[model samples]
Every structure is written in C-alpha cells, then in structure tokens.
Target: MAERCPYPFPRPTALGIPERLTGIHDEPLVPVVLPSGDEAVLLTRYQDVRQVLTDDRLSRNLDRPDAARISRHNSMFQDPRINPDPPEHTRVRNLVASAFSAARVQRLEPRIHAETDELLDAMERSGGPVDLNEALAFPLPVRVICSLLGVPDEDVALFRHWTSAFLSVSHFPREEIRAAMTEMSRYIAEHISHRRAHPGDDLVSAMIRAHDDEGRLSEYELQWWCRLLLLVGYETTATQLGGGVAMLLSHPEQLRLLRADPALLPNAIEELLRWKLVGSSVSMLRYATDDIELEDCVIKKGTSIIPAADCANQDPDRFFDPRTFDITRSDNPHLTFSLGPHFCIGASLARAELRIATQALLTRFPNLRLAVPAEELKRQEGALLEGFTEIPVTW
Candidate 1:
C-alpha cells in the first residue's frame, strides 16, 4: 500500500492558503488517499503542477481498465468532452466554445447587472441579518445560468439538489449520487427533446441545432454536455460569491480599500479567487499513460496524479508573500483555474458574475459586515469544494 496522508489538509483560521500545504511546498509530490480510497500523488510545486496538467502522458481517460479513479463513479459515464483526449476533446470543446466566449459573456452583462440589482432589492426589503448565501450568492448564478440554458425558474431547486449530489466526495452516499445523476440525465434528455420541438435562443437549443441540423454531436453527448454545464455553471460561481464576501468581510481593511476605489474590483476578484481556495486541493484525476520521471520521483504507469491548484497558486517562488492578500499586487498569474487545454470553459462567465456581484454588494450596502462573529462562521467540510456553508451579513 502507498503511504497516505489525509486528503484536504486543514486550512488556516484566517483567509489564506492551507498551512499544511505550505509546509510541504518544497516536496515535489505527496501521497494522499482519495475519498474513494484510491491512492494518488499530489503535486504541490507550481512547476510540477503545470507540467502534470499540460503533459500528454497524463491522461484524463479514466475508462481504461487500469485507469485510476477518484470515486466509484464510472469515468465512461462522465461527459465525453472532458474525459477523452485530443481530436475528440477538440471537437466537443470547439462546438461549445463560442457559446461561452468573451463576446457572448459581454453581451450578457446588462442582464447580469439587472439580476444583481433585483437580488439586492429583495435583500434590502428583508432588512437585517440575511444569509447572503441564500439571498444573493446562490440565486444570482443559478438565475443567470438557468436563463442561458433555458431551464425553467421552477426547476432551479431540483438542479441544485442534483448538482450538490454530483459534486460530493463522500458527503453523499454512492447510491444517492447515482440517483441524482440518473434524475439529472433523464431531465436533460427530456429537456433536449422539448428544445428540439420548441427551440429557443438558449444554449440547450443551440446544442440541439448542433446535433440535429449540423450533426456535430450525438444524442448522448448533448445530454452529458447539458448536465456538465448545469453543474459547473452555477456551483463554482455561487460558492465563490459566498466565499468572496466572507473573505472581504473578514479583512475590513481590504474591503475598505476595494470600496474606496471601485476600479480595484477586478484585481480584487483575482486575489480573492487565489486566496479563497474554493476549489479542491486537487484538479480532476489524471492517470499516467506510461512511466514518467519528475524532478524528484517516478510515477508508474496507471498511477493517479492530481495537480494541486490550491498549492501552486500559493507557491512563494511564483508570487511574493503569496499567502498575504494584496489585491493591488501586479502580475498575478494564479492557477485557480488549471492550465492547458482543459482550462475551465466557463471562466469568463464566472469572472463576469463575480465582478458584477462583488461591485453591486459593495456599492449598494456601504456598511456590509458579517452578522455572526468571524470565527463563528461554519466552514463546509468533507467535500471537494471548500467554502462556508452559511454567510450571514447585515448592511
């Protein structure tokens, strides 16, 4: 058996990177056991992480008999766009790339702003001590993504439950995860059929056109793509919104700095993303296609490797005083989003949502502060995504 340390080493009490990771930053790779009880190498150094992420030898094709899996879930059942290597991955990504382009995101800004204002209006009416997570963070991204995908407002809660179950590590039982996946898959298939007859200008309808009119994707591929988008589209940004707000409130000086100069919001968003560590310690699991030698050790073929984005972003070699939260810091090339071809497809949309949401909150509520004591806020545990479960705040 491989030497195993605890997965998701504990983070500090304050806003910053995990101290345990920093202590082992000099090590090329550390061994860890996944929630599924699979052993994998955790790449900590920035350069090592980038290499593993970009290397062709490190494959995401977990369908192979010897493929290392992070969970009991079948990799073959995963979205074809994400699991396959080149040519196939290239085709699927290209087909959907235009939908999430910077131009498309820019066009959606007016609607995003309107949505933000509407949420704020409701929060204001509710008066003091609101759970910002429920009031704004959760709703904004869900509404935006749902509108883009043509999902009905009534079904938002259903998708939320499905997404929660899908993204779980061990927080949810395997049977529960499978049930959620089955329900979500069935819903997407039905939704696609509906879109085919009554097509709209949403992404789902566009995908239908790609499949039926252009033959760019298959029926199964279309369903998986829709399912993947629904989960990623809201989960990441929603959690980030809650985490970002909590981080800002925790550091009043930084919050004041951002408020004094609203232009700093973009930079502040980047800093928050890097500092918040909302993502898991590891990126998606990749298996070594063949034996590979790193700077310090060898990874045998079929061994699993996880590029630790959280660790790389805080690498002192890459950034000065990396642990310190400095929004104005220049040349911030953080790897909160992994590098290479599999880079986050919805990154631009996520950034736009965070920027708009952050700006709206700060501008509208000049005195926004945490309702509960800073230390009292509960951090979500036993999950791949790390964030506060509830963030109560008052203006």
Candidate 2:
C-alpha cells in the first residue's frame, strides 16, 4: 500500500473540478489524509458514494476518540448538538421535513421570487461591472432565509461574519471559530426564547411548537435545528445561485436555450446542481460500525469515509455526457445532495431558490454576462465549503 494522498484534492478555481478526482477511475476507494491530519478513504464513483450515503452502518458520530477530525481550525462538525441514532434521526428529520420541505417551501416561493427581484432591481440600477455575488447572490438567499427562519433581515452582515467562522476548515484560528460559534449559538438561543414568548409562523417558532406543544424535538435538537437551518439555508443556496449564473453566462448555448424556452428553468436548475462543485461540506465524515463489504473492497471497522458528491455527480456511468453542460438533459439523478437517510433535508428549498434566482436573472437581465473571465474569478481553492468570493457580472 502506498502512502495516502492529501484530501480535498484541490480544484483549480471556484468552478473547476479537481484533476485528482477526475483521475481516480481505477480506484473506487482511495486512501487520503484530511486537513486535520486524520486518515480517511475517498469514494468518487456514483455507486460507492450512494452506497455510503444509504448505508445505515456508516455513522456520523465524530465524538469518538478514533473518529477523524474533519477540520483542524473549525469544530462545528464536532458540536455535540444532535448525533442521534437512527430512530432519533428519523424523528428529528420528520419534524424538520414537515416544516422545511415541499409544502412550506411552496408557500415560501412567492417570497423567494420577490426577494430575488429586489436584488436584481438593485443590480440593474448599478448598470455594469458589479459583483453579482455581493449584490445579489449572497444577499437574496440571506434575506429569504432570514424571512423563513424569522431572524431580522437587517442582521445579514452579522450572519455573514458568523457563518464564515462556523464553516471554516482552516480559514480562522480555533479561538475565533469558537467565538463565532458561541455568539451565533447565543443569538439563536435568544431567538428561540423569544419565539417561545411570542410564537410566529416562522420555522424557529414551528420547531418551538414541535418541541413544546408536540413531542417531536428535544430542547437541544430544536435549537440545533434552527442553527443548522440558518447555516445551510443561505450559504449553500447562495453558492449554487452564484455558480448557476456563472455556468449559464459561460455556456452561451445553454443561456440561449433558457432564454428561448423559459420553461427549461426547472431542468436548468438540476443541470446546474449536477455540474458545479459549488461546495465541499456535503461530504460529511462517517465512521464504519463494522467491516462492510463493497464492490471495490471491504471497508474495515472504525474507518472514516468521505463520499465526494461533486465527483460522483460527474460520474460518466450515471450521467450521460457529464462534462458537457446540457440544460435539457432530463435524466439527472445527481447526488449533489447526499442520498437516502442522511440526505439534505433542505434539498427542496435549495432547488426552489435556484429556480427563482435563475428565472429572475433571465427576466431581468437577458444580456447578463461575466464581467471578468471565468478563470479570473476568485475563491479560496481549498476552503471547506468553496464558493466564488466574487462573481463579477454585467448586463
């Protein structure tokens, strides 16, 4: 056995896929070392990635002494909030899915569109050479999430600070990351307390009802639900929205198809989700409970696994013409959201936001194009949840 390669498999740019991930065809499970100096195996094939995601034996309990520390500078993944067994996970997911998924998200659609339009209106006033990321991509999702999560929208700047620290792999010192987590926890805790005093129709209040009036979530689970929703709600969506714009702008043919049909927005969203390596946080740390047999090899007991969803999305076996971005491609079953039990609870919400953002841009600025070359766009190449820091665009 050769020495393990370094993990993360560095991408060339925010939108670029890593060369290493592309070259791991002969190996299904490759040994690697994480940023925290922990050993793990990478699963790049769609079959292996999905198998890990759906496997009940693979646990998310990083509290164990032997479990891999995913990042050295950040501890949010290690937070002792909700490391539930299967049953508890189901219960918590049920409560959250009710409040978060299709029905509630359907109601939130109008709000998403309105918020998207508001951002576009501001961008339109500026004319050209604006960072669409700063003006629209980041703000719209933050605003929508704040509205749904019942936090003050004016506190967006504070959240921008809080989330960056909370998700940092090595971006901040351990002390600063802890401080940000602590402050954000206090902020959410206070909001939960207030929601108890004066419950509203927002998600926090809904979870409060589930905890108090119903018996769905414990106090800890309820609070963590709010924190998770707030953390994931904006960042992932903002990343996808920004990347989606960059994708369409770079592929003028796809943009032309979208402009011509206008009905391809739904398919366009799926393609965008399938194509971009928008973030890396989806590949959560999972520990093997026992020796599990796989097509490639046996995953030994007590080993850490990372199902590289972005790489899996590009798997040629699952997706036809995976490299070429096609808006009309109908059979996109991408694992951008990890599959099965531990799947992203907010997948529906993310899809809705992506559709709304893209549609609004199509309607508002038909001539939207990148102000800088796609290669010139900047992001921390190996940041935990990588996204473009600036997606400068003009119309």
Candidate 3:
C-alpha cells in the first residue's frame, strides 16, 4: 500500500481540507505537534473557523507569550491590533487603517489599469506559449506595490525573491528565512531614508509624512509597516492572479461569459477567489489565550488554532453548490481577504488590479488557452500560498 497522507490538508487528494475534515473522522479535536514543537488544533468546519476567528479567547499574536516566541523578526502577529486583544489591537489597527481608506484606494484604479495594460502589452509581444505566471501574474502585483509604495521598479525582482523566501515552507532552513526577511527590512529602510530626504506621492512617502507630522509612528514602526505591507502586497496578490488565471482557463465557459459581460467582472473576481480554494493555512496562527469551548471541544490556552480560510469559503453550508465556479455567483461572501479586524487593507486595490487584468487579458487574447494540460503544469509546493509555477498560455 502507498504511504498514508497527512491528516487535514488531504495531500494527494482531490478535495482539500474541507473534504478531509468533513469526511470520516475518528476524533472531534485532534492534536498534532508542529515541527517547531508548538501544539495546535487544526479546525475544519465553517462554524468552528468562524468561532475561533470571533472568539475573544483566541489571540492572533502568538509572540505575546514569552514561551511562544516562534520568530525573532517582528511580524504582523506583533501588531497587537491584528492579533491582540481589546484596546491594544484596536488602537494600532485604527492607526494602520488611516493609510488604507476607501477614498485612497479609489484613486488607485487608474494606476491599476495602466499597470495591467503595460504587463499585457509585454505579454502580447512575448507571444503565446508564454508563462503567464512570470510574464503577468508574478510581476503585476510587484509593479503595483512598487508604484503605490514608491519603491523603484528595479528593486522589485530582488524584493520578490526575498519575500518569496520569507514565506517559503519548504525544508529550507529557518535561518535562511530569517536572513531573507532581514535583507528585505534593510532594503526597505534604505528606501525610507531616501524618501525622507525627498518625499514623493507614494504610500511610503505619505507614511513618512504621517510619521513626521505627529509622533504617531516610530521609526521602527514605519520600517516594519513598510516591510509588512510590501510582503503582503506582492505575495497574496500574486497568488490571486496566478490562481485566478488558472480558474479562468479551467472554466473557459465562464471566461466566455465574463468576456461577453464585462459588468460581471466584480462578481467574477469573487467567484475566482472562491474557486481556487487557496490559503491552505491562515497567514497568522491564532493562539487560545484561555480555555475556549466550541460545540465539540475545549481548546486549551497557549495552543495555536489555524482557521481554514479555503475550507470556510467552500463550506457547503455557507455557499450553495460549493464546488462549482460560476462567474456570476451572486452570493459570494468569500473570506479570501478575510473578515473582521484582520481583513486585508489592500482589497480594493487588489480587486481593481484583478478586474483590469482579467478584462484586458480576455480582450487582448480572446482565444487564450493553456499551452499544456492542467496536470502537466507545475504548482509551487511547500508554501501556504500556492500558484502555478509557470502558466504557459497560448492564444
């Protein structure tokens, strides 16, 4: 017999966690020690995921406990508002939200369109059998974030490699991840220094001004914020673009519908996000600060609980016909950008980029199709955020 696959994620299986958890199970609350020797409870149900997300007993910042220091580098988990309880998290998040307002994102639409077109133009010139992942998906968000944050375009490729290393889960040594993150921080700090001397109309410059006008943000705070924003800005959106293109290509009929009805673009983006079933694990692991009881079990304090974003999004109870990829799926409430206090700040800008990219892609190459079979394509493995390593497309 073949070796048994790992529990929960259903590696080498068709459906992912949603199926594994909902399938036959021996126990209600399973306990597994992670490679780091940290104890955690892997949740699968929508109700369970939501309860953990909303529960006051659960903490997003595991680094709070002296014993739970998982990483030395500062992380979003360090942002008390993102992962902390009550007033601390609230205060910090309020300060962060000022930088990501709806009005501010509205101004980004034109830039998003221009960036999408530029990439598409390059893609057209490169011709078919092009790797969309390299040509478009990978670079689009990097360029968008660079344009938004005022980072020089030349720095993006190196930063992309650094951020990629930061998020890597492969058997690559932990020290390597740390070094990459440190390099990323150093690079961003240098840019911050440059911007302080000569401010521009980018997000980092705006943040530098904010730091100057009032002592609202510390130098360290600004540095970490820039690093945090850039890492997330590229990694998540790149996954979306790669995954979204895979989804569109997989469902050509939906692409046809989208091409015919450009008005359906917004809804289609939601559907695309839902269809991918990405986010195999939460970006940040939430720790139970105290004993917390759900319908089935009581989670002990000091334990980590990772909410299944993909599972919750595909929960049949929450979403009707959870498997289908309908471009016009009317009642799409995906947690892809997540929900509540920890929701993604750049969602509007991300949406604009996706909308423009998708619209322009189908318009420019109406006959776009995969150059190879789906099974033949390689997906980047050993990482929580997954996408095609190279999506070769022919038009």
| lDDT of the candidates, in the order given | 0.80, 0.80, 0.69
Q: By lDDT, is 1 or 3 better? A: 1
What is the TM-score of each predicted model, taking all chains together? Answer: 0.94, 0.95, 0.87
lDDT of 2 by residue, 216-235 (tens): 78888887878878876789
For candidate 1, which ten residues in a row score worst on lDDT?
73-82
| Cα lDDT of model 3 by residue, 74-166, tens digit | 233555434355565565567667556778777777777787788888888886778887888878888888887888878888876777676
Ranking by TM-score: 2, 1, 3
Tens-place lDDT per residue, model 1, 147-245, is 999998888878778877877766777788888889988898888888888999899999899999999888778887898888778888888988888
Can you list the residue pairs that collide in candidate 1? Answer: none
In candidate 1, clashing pairs total 0
Q: Mind sharing the TM-score for model 2?
A: 0.95
